[model samples]
Target: MSLPLMPKATAVWLVENTSLTFEQIADFCGMHALEIQAIADGEVAIGITGLNPIAKSQLTPEEIQRCEADPDTRLKLRPAESHLTRARKGARYTPVSKRNDRPDGIAWLLKNHPEISDAQICKLMGTTRPTIQAIRDKSHWNSANIKPRNPVTLGLCSEADLEKALAVSQPRSSSIFLVRASEASALSQPAAPADTGHYGRTEPQDAHSEAESLFRRPASPAPAESGTETDPDDSADF
Candidate 1:
Protein backbone atom coordinates (compact mmCIF):
# COMPACT_ATOMS: atom_id res chain seq x y z
CA MET A 1 0.00 0.00 0.00
CA SER A 2 1.20 3.51 -0.77
CA LEU A 3 0.81 6.01 2.01
CA PRO A 4 -0.51 9.45 1.31
CA LEU A 5 1.51 12.60 2.02
CA MET A 6 1.51 13.32 5.76
CA PRO A 7 0.17 9.86 6.53
CA LYS A 8 -0.35 10.68 10.22
CA ALA A 9 -2.22 13.86 9.35
CA THR A 10 -4.39 12.13 6.76
CA ALA A 11 -5.10 9.32 9.22
CA VAL A 12 -6.00 11.92 11.77
CA TRP A 13 -8.44 13.50 9.33
CA LEU A 14 -10.05 10.12 8.45
CA VAL A 15 -10.35 9.16 12.13
CA GLU A 16 -12.02 12.45 13.06
CA ASN A 17 -14.41 12.87 10.09
CA THR A 18 -15.24 9.39 8.73
CA SER A 19 -16.87 6.22 10.06
CA LEU A 20 -14.01 4.08 8.66
CA THR A 21 -12.35 1.35 10.77
CA PHE A 22 -8.83 1.41 12.22
CA GLU A 23 -7.75 -1.48 9.92
CA GLN A 24 -8.94 0.40 6.84
CA ILE A 25 -7.05 3.49 7.87
CA ALA A 26 -4.01 1.44 8.75
CA ASP A 27 -4.08 -0.40 5.43
CA PHE A 28 -4.40 2.88 3.50
CA CYS A 29 -1.79 4.79 5.55
CA GLY A 30 0.65 1.83 5.80
CA MET A 31 0.52 2.04 9.58
CA HIS A 32 -0.42 -0.52 12.24
CA ALA A 33 -4.03 -0.72 13.43
CA LEU A 34 -2.83 -0.01 16.99
CA GLU A 35 -1.14 3.20 15.79
CA ILE A 36 -4.33 4.24 14.02
CA GLN A 37 -6.31 3.44 17.18
CA ALA A 38 -3.94 5.60 19.27
CA ILE A 39 -4.24 8.40 16.72
CA ALA A 40 -8.06 8.09 16.84
CA ASP A 41 -7.93 8.25 20.65
CA GLY A 42 -5.84 11.45 20.46
CA GLU A 43 -3.06 9.74 22.42
CA VAL A 44 -0.46 10.27 19.64
CA ALA A 45 0.59 13.32 17.60
CA ILE A 46 -1.46 15.59 19.86
CA GLY A 47 -0.67 18.82 17.98
CA ILE A 48 -0.90 17.44 14.41
CA THR A 49 -3.57 18.77 12.02
CA GLY A 50 -5.85 16.66 9.81
CA LEU A 51 -4.97 16.67 6.11
CA ASN A 52 -7.80 16.06 3.64
CA PRO A 53 -6.87 13.33 1.18
CA ILE A 54 -9.38 14.67 -1.37
CA ALA A 55 -7.70 18.05 -1.40
CA LYS A 56 -4.28 16.43 -1.80
CA SER A 57 -5.63 14.39 -4.81
CA GLN A 58 -4.75 11.22 -2.90
CA LEU A 59 -8.33 9.88 -2.80
CA THR A 60 -11.85 10.64 -3.98
CA PRO A 61 -14.88 11.31 -1.80
CA GLU A 62 -16.69 8.42 -3.48
CA GLU A 63 -13.94 6.03 -2.52
CA ILE A 64 -14.07 7.28 1.04
CA GLN A 65 -17.85 6.85 1.10
CA ARG A 66 -17.59 3.35 -0.37
CA CYS A 67 -15.02 2.29 2.21
CA GLU A 68 -17.02 3.90 4.98
CA ALA A 69 -20.18 2.07 3.86
CA ASP A 70 -18.37 -1.28 3.89
CA PRO A 71 -15.71 -1.52 6.63
CA ASP A 72 -14.10 -4.39 4.67
CA THR A 73 -13.31 -2.22 1.63
CA ARG A 74 -9.95 -0.44 1.70
CA LEU A 75 -9.34 3.03 0.39
CA LYS A 76 -7.69 3.28 -3.04
CA LEU A 77 -5.82 6.34 -4.22
CA ARG A 78 -7.03 8.13 -7.34
CA PRO A 79 -4.69 7.46 -10.24
CA ALA A 80 -2.76 10.31 -11.79
CA GLU A 81 -2.60 10.65 -15.58
CA SER A 82 0.75 9.94 -17.22
CA HIS A 83 2.39 12.04 -19.94
CA LEU A 84 1.07 9.71 -22.66
CA THR A 85 -2.53 10.46 -21.67
CA ARG A 86 -2.06 14.23 -21.63
CA ALA A 87 -2.59 16.46 -24.67
CA ARG A 88 0.40 18.54 -25.67
CA LYS A 89 0.22 22.28 -25.18
CA GLY A 90 1.83 25.24 -27.00
CA ALA A 91 3.18 25.54 -30.55
CA ARG A 92 4.99 22.72 -32.36
CA TYR A 93 8.53 23.34 -33.59
CA THR A 94 9.95 22.68 -37.07
CA PRO A 95 13.60 22.58 -38.13
CA VAL A 96 14.94 25.41 -40.37
CA SER A 97 15.52 23.06 -43.30
CA LYS A 98 12.03 21.58 -42.96
CA ARG A 99 10.40 25.03 -42.57
CA ASN A 100 10.49 25.63 -46.32
CA ASP A 101 8.71 22.30 -46.90
CA ARG A 102 5.76 23.34 -44.69
CA PRO A 103 3.99 24.97 -47.63
CA ASP A 104 4.16 21.79 -49.68
CA GLY A 105 2.82 19.71 -46.80
CA ILE A 106 0.06 22.23 -46.14
CA ALA A 107 -0.86 22.21 -49.82
CA TRP A 108 -0.99 18.44 -49.83
CA LEU A 109 -3.25 18.31 -46.78
CA LEU A 110 -5.49 21.04 -48.20
CA LYS A 111 -5.80 19.40 -51.59
CA ASN A 112 -6.16 15.85 -50.29
CA HIS A 113 -8.03 16.35 -47.00
CA PRO A 114 -9.88 19.62 -47.29
CA GLU A 115 -12.05 18.51 -44.40
CA ILE A 116 -9.09 19.02 -42.06
CA SER A 117 -9.31 22.37 -40.27
CA ASP A 118 -6.68 25.11 -40.34
CA ALA A 119 -5.91 24.42 -36.63
CA GLN A 120 -5.39 20.72 -37.36
CA ILE A 121 -3.08 21.52 -40.29
CA CYS A 122 -1.12 23.96 -38.15
CA LYS A 123 -0.72 21.32 -35.46
CA LEU A 124 0.18 18.61 -37.99
CA MET A 125 2.65 20.67 -40.08
CA GLY A 126 3.83 23.33 -37.58
CA THR A 127 2.75 26.15 -39.89
CA THR A 128 0.81 29.36 -39.18
CA ARG A 129 -2.75 30.15 -40.30
CA PRO A 130 -1.63 32.94 -42.61
CA THR A 131 0.56 30.57 -44.56
CA ILE A 132 -2.30 28.09 -44.86
CA GLN A 133 -4.71 30.82 -45.97
CA ALA A 134 -2.23 32.27 -48.44
CA ILE A 135 -1.72 28.86 -49.95
CA ARG A 136 -5.49 28.24 -49.98
CA ASP A 137 -6.10 31.57 -51.72
CA LYS A 138 -3.18 31.10 -54.13
CA SER A 139 -1.47 34.19 -52.71
CA HIS A 140 1.63 32.60 -51.22
CA TRP A 141 4.87 34.10 -52.61
CA ASN A 142 5.88 30.72 -53.98
CA SER A 143 2.39 29.60 -54.94
CA ALA A 144 3.47 28.79 -58.50
CA ASN A 145 6.45 26.77 -57.31
CA ILE A 146 4.77 24.99 -54.38
CA LYS A 147 3.87 21.36 -55.10
CA PRO A 148 1.44 19.33 -53.06
CA ARG A 149 3.63 16.80 -51.25
CA ASN A 150 2.82 14.34 -48.48
CA PRO A 151 3.80 15.55 -45.01
CA VAL A 152 4.94 12.06 -44.04
CA THR A 153 7.09 11.73 -47.18
CA LEU A 154 8.49 15.24 -46.62
CA GLY A 155 9.38 14.28 -42.98
CA LEU A 156 7.07 16.94 -41.58
CA CYS A 157 5.14 14.38 -39.49
CA SER A 158 4.96 10.66 -38.89
CA GLU A 159 2.45 8.46 -40.74
CA ALA A 160 0.79 7.70 -37.40
CA ASP A 161 0.34 11.37 -36.59
CA LEU A 162 -1.06 12.10 -40.04
CA GLU A 163 -3.47 9.15 -39.75
CA LYS A 164 -4.61 10.31 -36.31
CA ALA A 165 -5.37 13.79 -37.67
CA LEU A 166 -7.28 12.30 -40.59
CA ALA A 167 -9.32 10.07 -38.26
CA VAL A 168 -10.40 13.12 -36.25
CA SER A 169 -11.61 14.79 -39.47
CA GLN A 170 -13.35 11.70 -41.00
CA PRO A 171 -16.11 10.62 -38.60
CA ARG A 172 -18.91 12.81 -39.97
CA SER A 173 -18.62 11.36 -43.47
CA SER A 174 -18.58 7.67 -42.54
CA SER A 175 -22.12 6.32 -42.09
CA ILE A 176 -23.93 8.16 -44.91
CA PHE A 177 -21.16 7.60 -47.42
CA LEU A 178 -21.01 3.88 -46.71
CA VAL A 179 -24.77 3.55 -47.10
CA ARG A 180 -24.75 5.42 -50.43
CA ALA A 181 -21.84 3.47 -51.78
CA SER A 182 -23.50 0.16 -50.96
CA GLU A 183 -26.73 1.32 -52.63
CA ALA A 184 -24.87 2.41 -55.79
CA SER A 185 -23.03 -0.88 -55.99
CA ALA A 186 -26.27 -2.79 -55.58
CA LEU A 187 -27.94 -0.82 -58.38
CA SER A 188 -25.09 -1.31 -60.84
CA GLN A 189 -25.41 -5.11 -60.75
CA PRO A 190 -27.96 -6.99 -62.94
CA ALA A 191 -30.65 -9.18 -61.41
CA ALA A 192 -30.81 -12.88 -62.33
CA PRO A 193 -34.05 -14.79 -63.06
CA ALA A 194 -35.30 -17.60 -60.83
CA ASP A 195 -35.00 -20.35 -63.48
CA THR A 196 -31.67 -21.00 -65.17
CA GLY A 197 -30.95 -23.37 -68.13
CA HIS A 198 -27.72 -25.09 -69.18
CA TYR A 199 -24.45 -23.13 -69.48
CA GLY A 200 -25.46 -20.86 -66.54
CA ARG A 201 -28.11 -19.03 -68.58
CA THR A 202 -31.31 -17.58 -67.11
CA GLU A 203 -34.61 -17.89 -69.00
CA PRO A 204 -38.25 -17.26 -68.08
CA GLN A 205 -40.21 -20.53 -68.58
CA ASP A 206 -43.94 -20.45 -67.55
CA ALA A 207 -45.17 -23.73 -66.00
CA HIS A 208 -48.25 -23.94 -68.32
CA SER A 209 -46.22 -23.34 -71.53
CA GLU A 210 -43.54 -25.86 -70.51
CA ALA A 211 -46.21 -28.50 -69.65
CA GLU A 212 -47.98 -28.01 -73.05
CA SER A 213 -44.71 -28.39 -75.00
CA LEU A 214 -43.67 -31.53 -73.08
CA PHE A 215 -47.03 -33.48 -73.18
CA ARG A 216 -48.15 -32.58 -76.78
CA ARG A 217 -48.13 -35.78 -79.01
CA PRO A 218 -46.53 -35.96 -82.50
CA ALA A 219 -48.75 -35.54 -85.68
CA SER A 220 -50.33 -38.74 -87.28
CA PRO A 221 -48.69 -40.01 -90.55
CA ALA A 222 -50.11 -38.38 -93.74
CA PRO A 223 -52.66 -40.36 -95.96
CA ALA A 224 -50.39 -42.82 -97.89
CA GLU A 225 -50.60 -43.71 -101.62
CA SER A 226 -53.84 -41.71 -102.24
CA GLY A 227 -52.69 -40.78 -105.80
CA THR A 228 -49.97 -43.30 -106.94
CA GLU A 229 -49.11 -47.07 -106.43
CA THR A 230 -46.76 -49.69 -107.95
CA ASP A 231 -48.50 -52.83 -109.67
CA PRO A 232 -47.15 -56.15 -108.52
CA ASP A 233 -48.47 -58.23 -111.69
CA ASP A 234 -47.16 -55.94 -114.49
CA SER A 235 -44.22 -57.32 -116.56
CA ALA A 236 -42.05 -55.77 -119.32
CA ASP A 237 -40.39 -57.71 -122.26
CA PHE A 238 -36.66 -57.39 -122.47
Candidate 2:
Protein backbone atom coordinates (compact mmCIF):
# COMPACT_ATOMS: atom_id res chain seq x y z
CA MET A 1 0.00 0.00 0.00
CA SER A 2 1.16 3.54 -0.74
CA LEU A 3 1.85 5.63 2.35
CA PRO A 4 1.02 9.30 2.54
CA LEU A 5 3.84 11.82 1.90
CA MET A 6 3.50 12.86 5.54
CA PRO A 7 2.18 10.01 7.74
CA LYS A 8 2.10 11.90 11.05
CA ALA A 9 0.38 14.88 9.49
CA THR A 10 -2.12 12.61 7.76
CA ALA A 11 -2.75 10.84 11.07
CA VAL A 12 -3.35 14.19 12.72
CA TRP A 13 -5.85 15.20 10.04
CA LEU A 14 -7.70 11.87 10.31
CA VAL A 15 -7.86 12.12 14.09
CA GLU A 16 -9.31 15.62 13.97
CA ASN A 17 -11.73 15.49 11.02
CA THR A 18 -12.99 11.89 10.86
CA SER A 19 -14.70 9.44 13.16
CA LEU A 20 -12.46 6.64 11.86
CA THR A 21 -11.03 4.29 14.46
CA PHE A 22 -7.39 4.60 15.48
CA GLU A 23 -6.62 1.32 13.77
CA GLN A 24 -8.13 2.51 10.53
CA ILE A 25 -6.22 5.78 10.61
CA ALA A 26 -2.97 4.09 11.61
CA ASP A 27 -3.32 1.46 8.90
CA PHE A 28 -3.78 4.20 6.29
CA CYS A 29 -0.90 6.27 7.60
CA GLY A 30 1.44 3.27 8.18
CA MET A 31 1.84 4.15 11.86
CA HIS A 32 0.93 2.67 15.21
CA ALA A 33 -2.60 3.20 16.55
CA LEU A 34 -1.08 4.41 19.84
CA GLU A 35 0.63 7.20 17.88
CA ILE A 36 -2.70 8.26 16.39
CA GLN A 37 -4.19 8.35 19.90
CA ALA A 38 -1.26 10.47 21.09
CA ILE A 39 -1.96 12.94 18.31
CA ALA A 40 -5.57 13.06 19.41
CA ASP A 41 -4.48 13.60 23.05
CA GLY A 42 -2.04 16.39 22.05
CA GLU A 43 0.82 14.44 23.58
CA VAL A 44 2.89 14.13 20.38
CA ALA A 45 3.33 16.11 17.15
CA ILE A 46 2.13 19.21 18.99
CA GLY A 47 2.93 21.84 16.35
CA ILE A 48 2.99 19.83 13.08
CA THR A 49 0.59 20.95 10.35
CA GLY A 50 -1.97 18.40 9.18
CA LEU A 51 -2.03 17.61 5.46
CA ASN A 52 -5.44 16.84 3.99
CA PRO A 53 -5.37 13.74 1.81
CA ILE A 54 -8.49 14.94 -0.03
CA ALA A 55 -6.65 18.06 -1.28
CA LYS A 56 -3.60 16.00 -2.36
CA SER A 57 -5.83 13.59 -4.35
CA GLN A 58 -4.49 10.82 -2.16
CA LEU A 59 -8.03 10.03 -0.95
CA THR A 60 -11.58 10.48 -2.11
CA PRO A 61 -14.29 12.01 0.15
CA GLU A 62 -16.63 9.09 -0.62
CA GLU A 63 -13.96 6.57 0.46
CA ILE A 64 -13.46 8.45 3.73
CA GLN A 65 -17.22 8.43 4.39
CA ARG A 66 -17.48 4.73 3.54
CA CYS A 67 -14.82 3.93 6.16
CA GLU A 68 -16.26 6.43 8.68
CA ALA A 69 -19.61 4.63 8.50
CA ASP A 70 -17.95 1.26 9.26
CA PRO A 71 -15.22 1.16 11.88
CA ASP A 72 -13.93 -2.16 10.58
CA THR A 73 -13.20 -0.78 7.14
CA ARG A 74 -9.71 0.63 6.41
CA LEU A 75 -8.98 3.75 4.42
CA LYS A 76 -6.97 3.15 1.24
CA LEU A 77 -4.45 5.48 -0.41
CA ARG A 78 -5.43 6.47 -3.96
CA PRO A 79 -2.90 5.22 -6.53
CA ALA A 80 -0.84 7.84 -8.30
CA GLU A 81 -1.40 8.44 -12.06
CA SER A 82 2.24 7.61 -12.88
CA HIS A 83 3.62 4.71 -10.88
CA LEU A 84 7.35 5.25 -10.27
CA THR A 85 9.66 2.24 -10.21
CA ARG A 86 11.75 1.66 -7.09
CA ALA A 87 15.44 2.48 -7.48
CA ARG A 88 17.84 -0.45 -7.76
CA LYS A 89 19.76 -1.18 -4.58
CA GLY A 90 23.55 -0.69 -4.40
CA ALA A 91 26.36 -0.23 -1.90
CA ARG A 92 25.70 2.95 0.10
CA TYR A 93 28.16 5.35 1.72
CA THR A 94 27.86 6.23 5.42
CA PRO A 95 28.34 9.89 6.26
CA VAL A 96 31.60 10.55 8.18
CA SER A 97 29.69 12.11 11.06
CA LYS A 98 27.64 8.90 11.55
CA ARG A 99 30.34 6.36 10.55
CA ASN A 100 31.63 5.97 14.13
CA ASP A 101 28.12 4.99 15.24
CA ARG A 102 28.00 1.99 12.85
CA PRO A 103 29.33 -0.38 15.54
CA ASP A 104 26.45 0.56 17.84
CA GLY A 105 23.97 -0.10 15.05
CA ILE A 106 25.67 -3.41 14.25
CA ALA A 107 25.51 -4.40 17.92
CA TRP A 108 21.82 -3.71 18.05
CA LEU A 109 21.13 -5.77 14.91
CA LEU A 110 23.23 -8.66 16.23
CA LYS A 111 21.43 -8.66 19.59
CA ASN A 112 17.89 -8.06 18.38
CA HIS A 113 17.91 -9.91 15.05
CA PRO A 114 20.41 -12.74 15.32
CA GLU A 115 18.54 -14.62 12.65
CA ILE A 116 19.43 -11.91 10.14
CA SER A 117 22.64 -12.67 8.26
CA ASP A 118 25.83 -10.68 8.73
CA ALA A 119 25.73 -9.93 5.01
CA GLN A 120 22.26 -8.45 5.38
CA ILE A 121 23.41 -6.23 8.22
CA CYS A 122 26.43 -5.16 6.20
CA LYS A 123 24.27 -4.15 3.24
CA LEU A 124 21.75 -2.39 5.45
CA MET A 125 24.33 -0.37 7.36
CA GLY A 126 26.91 0.24 4.63
CA THR A 127 29.31 -1.92 6.59
CA THR A 128 31.50 -4.97 6.02
CA ARG A 129 31.50 -8.59 7.26
CA PRO A 130 34.64 -8.06 9.37
CA THR A 131 32.97 -5.22 11.24
CA ILE A 132 29.94 -7.42 11.92
CA GLN A 133 32.15 -10.32 13.05
CA ALA A 134 34.09 -8.12 15.45
CA ILE A 135 30.89 -7.00 17.10
CA ARG A 136 29.57 -10.57 17.25
CA ASP A 137 32.78 -11.81 18.92
CA LYS A 138 33.14 -8.75 21.15
CA SER A 139 36.53 -8.10 19.52
CA HIS A 140 35.85 -4.62 18.14
CA TRP A 141 38.24 -1.91 19.35
CA ASN A 142 35.28 0.18 20.58
CA SER A 143 33.33 -2.79 21.93
CA ALA A 144 33.11 -1.21 25.39
CA ASN A 145 31.72 2.02 23.98
CA ILE A 146 29.28 0.29 21.60
CA LYS A 147 25.83 0.62 23.12
CA PRO A 148 23.12 -1.07 21.09
CA ARG A 149 20.85 1.34 19.22
CA ASN A 150 18.54 0.94 16.24
CA PRO A 151 20.13 1.30 12.82
CA VAL A 152 17.24 3.51 11.78
CA THR A 153 17.71 5.70 14.86
CA LEU A 154 21.39 5.97 14.00
CA GLY A 155 20.45 6.92 10.41
CA LEU A 156 22.45 3.91 9.20
CA CYS A 157 19.56 2.12 7.50
CA SER A 158 15.88 2.48 6.66
CA GLU A 159 13.15 0.58 8.50
CA ALA A 160 11.96 -0.95 5.23
CA ASP A 161 15.38 -2.46 4.53
CA LEU A 162 15.65 -3.93 8.01
CA GLU A 163 12.12 -5.33 7.83
CA LYS A 164 12.87 -6.97 4.46
CA ALA A 165 16.02 -8.66 5.83
CA LEU A 166 14.11 -9.97 8.86
CA ALA A 167 11.32 -11.31 6.65
CA VAL A 168 13.87 -13.24 4.59
CA SER A 169 15.47 -14.74 7.71
CA GLN A 170 12.16 -15.75 9.38
CA PRO A 171 11.67 -19.08 7.59
CA ARG A 172 15.24 -20.18 8.34
CA SER A 173 14.81 -19.41 12.05
CA SER A 174 11.50 -21.30 12.15
CA SER A 175 13.04 -24.42 10.56
CA ILE A 176 15.95 -24.41 13.01
CA PHE A 177 13.53 -24.09 15.94
CA LEU A 178 11.47 -27.04 14.70
CA VAL A 179 14.57 -29.24 14.31
CA ARG A 180 15.74 -28.41 17.86
CA ALA A 181 12.28 -29.18 19.25
CA SER A 182 12.22 -32.62 17.63
CA GLU A 183 15.68 -33.45 19.03
CA ALA A 184 14.61 -32.39 22.54
CA SER A 185 11.43 -34.47 22.34
CA ALA A 186 13.42 -37.53 21.26
CA LEU A 187 15.86 -37.13 24.15
CA SER A 188 13.02 -36.81 26.69
CA GLN A 189 11.55 -40.27 25.94
CA PRO A 190 12.47 -43.24 28.21
CA ALA A 191 14.70 -45.96 26.79
CA ALA A 192 13.35 -49.52 26.27
CA PRO A 193 14.47 -52.13 28.87
CA ALA A 194 16.88 -54.91 27.86
CA ASP A 195 16.24 -58.58 28.62
CA THR A 196 18.94 -60.50 30.57
CA GLY A 197 19.34 -64.33 30.80
CA HIS A 198 21.04 -66.60 33.43
CA TYR A 199 24.64 -65.34 32.99
CA GLY A 200 23.77 -61.66 32.99
CA ARG A 201 24.13 -61.60 29.20
CA THR A 202 21.39 -60.76 26.68
CA GLU A 203 20.02 -64.08 25.51
CA PRO A 204 17.65 -65.05 22.71
CA GLN A 205 14.27 -66.37 23.83
CA ASP A 206 13.56 -70.14 23.38
CA ALA A 207 11.07 -72.79 24.50
CA HIS A 208 12.07 -74.27 27.89
CA SER A 209 11.15 -77.90 28.92
CA GLU A 210 10.03 -77.90 32.59
CA ALA A 211 9.56 -81.78 32.64
CA GLU A 212 13.23 -82.35 31.58
CA SER A 213 14.44 -80.28 34.52
CA LEU A 214 12.23 -82.27 36.94
CA PHE A 215 13.36 -85.76 35.71
CA ARG A 216 17.14 -85.06 35.59
CA ARG A 217 17.76 -85.21 39.40
CA PRO A 218 20.83 -87.32 40.53
CA ALA A 219 20.01 -90.58 42.44
CA SER A 220 20.96 -90.85 46.15
CA PRO A 221 23.92 -93.17 47.00
CA ALA A 222 23.03 -96.51 48.64
CA PRO A 223 23.40 -96.56 52.41
CA ALA A 224 26.86 -97.70 53.51
CA GLU A 225 27.11 -101.24 55.05
CA SER A 226 27.19 -100.42 58.75
CA GLY A 227 29.91 -102.07 60.83
CA THR A 228 30.08 -105.03 58.38
CA GLU A 229 33.86 -105.09 58.44
CA THR A 230 35.45 -107.94 56.59
CA ASP A 231 38.89 -106.52 57.26
CA PRO A 232 41.61 -108.23 55.21
CA ASP A 233 39.17 -110.31 53.08
CA ASP A 234 37.24 -107.23 51.97
CA SER A 235 38.91 -107.51 48.56
CA ALA A 236 37.17 -110.91 47.85
CA ASP A 237 34.11 -110.75 45.64
CA PHE A 238 31.03 -110.59 47.84
lDDT of 1 at 110: 94
Candidate 2 structure quality by residue, lDDT tens digits, 36-70: 88899999999766777786667889999999899
User: What TM-score does each of the candidates earn?
Assistant: 0.37, 0.50
Among all windows of ten consecutive residues in candidate 2, which has the lowest summed lDDT? Answer: 204-213
User: How displaced is residue 200 in candidate 2, in Å?
Assistant: 11
TM-score of 1: 0.37
Best by TM-score: 2
lDDT by residue (tens digit), candidate 1, 86-145: 345777778899988889989999999887888888898888899899999999999999
lDDT against the true structure, per candidate, is 0.82, 0.82
Question: Which parts of model 1 have CA positions greater than 4 angstroms off?
Answer: 1-87, 172-238
Superposed on all Cα atoms, the candidates' RMSDs to the truth, in angstroms, are 18.8, 11.4
